[model samples]
Target: MRSVPEWAQQRGFGIRVEWGRAGAVAIGAGAAGVVVIDVLSFTTSVSVATAAGTAVFPYRWRDGTARSFAAERGAALAVGRREVSVAQPWSLSPAAIRRAPFTERLVLPSPNGSAIAASVEGTPVVAACLRNYSAVADWLLQQGWGTPARPIAIVAAGEQWPGTETVRPALEDWLGAGALAAALLDRGIDTPSPEAYSAASTFTALPDTPGLLRTSASGRELISGGFPDDVDLAVDLDADNTVPVLENGAFTDHGR
Candidate 1:
């Protein structure tokens, strides 16, 4: 664990990868932009929804207040995978969110990705997935974010088990973040931290990303939950150019 100043002094750009809420808070303050990657579903869903011209509001938890929160914002609440149907237009299932009727805004609550995104404050936050890492990397470079003065933090929103206080690092999210880091490294930013380098290397080494995601722990869980289509949607590399950036308590398409 290197200190922040050390990172700033050693590299023109600090490309650090973190695990969950604690990781988000640790690196978020100094980051010019924070890319939250929840490859299993959360960020993937946001990317799909925003690309289809919808705004997404991220909520930390799916509880009793989620419905009112969505209603107050004039947005629909995205239900869990089990609750999804034609009547429930939005859900954590990326496939469902992609095919649902167009919505101007939707409130998506998740115990993992959405929680981490909402936990980050005062930093420009963006959602990234394997499907749109290229676009995200391009957009970050265009904003001059990877330079030393303006570093970027790529946070992998790993899953959490109920009643657990620690983060459960998900392989899919790690690969997703690694893909974005690899994109940045390829674009001429070469100061990623050791952990970041490892992640990038892992992604680059994977010959078949979608195939691996389909068999990962998170992927297997989603498959058992009857949301295998969500995993399929998540692995579509460079599928869209839309970047869902958090702004004014909502995520809207930043780079379209």
Candidate 2:
């Protein structure tokens, strides 16, 4: 039995955490609610846009120049990479995105992971990361959240190589998912598998190595390549407690 299941067996809660797309897809297919994490920024932007009450038209820029496009359109943009620079303006906080009027459009540029998370729609989409795990869990539990037959799916945006098929899971995303799973288990939910526990534990046990961020594939590629500030922002935990929820075509910090 996995640690989460074991824990759930003892506590009577049914929560589980899984690693990778396979697990996430399984849960999404079976669950009523789904939370996707795109720490790099895409998913975050989607969550923010939805929370702010605007319909999101998620589009990918082949040249990765969405920022400029958004600027040209007078839409607010947030850089999700590490290292903020003077050349880039309109940088704002997650809270600001949540509080902004729902009509404003958001153009988010992250390292390379969050876009997939934006693809999930039919059901309400909420941003999930270590930063908002607790607040999100509380909100979910309070509503007696869950479809009797459908499970909740949490998708973590992993690092993807530009022209390759390889996509690596980031430590932060894994840890964030684990934390969310733990919170769900705390509320009497189903438990995840052994792999989930191992993944979460591995991330949690990291010793905070010097230049660890610089060494990470996503951090290194994005920072050295152009989005230095996004790495730092993505890793920040508990920066915002507001859980953005999707409503109509947009999202609002207001819980639905």
lDDT, candidate 1, 108-130, per-residue tens: 99988899888887889999999
lDDT by residue (92-189, candidate 2, tens digit) is 33433454445566555444333444445576666676556777877777766632444455666566656764667675566667667667665665
Number of the top candidate by lDDT? 1
**What 10-residue stretch in candidate 2 is worst by lDDT?**
5-14
lDDT of each: 0.87, 0.53
**Residue 123, candidate 1: C-alpha displacement in angstroms:** 0.8
lDDT, candidate 2, equals: 0.53
Model 1: what TM-score?
0.93
- lDDT for model 1 comes to 0.87
Specify the highest-TM-score model's number.
1
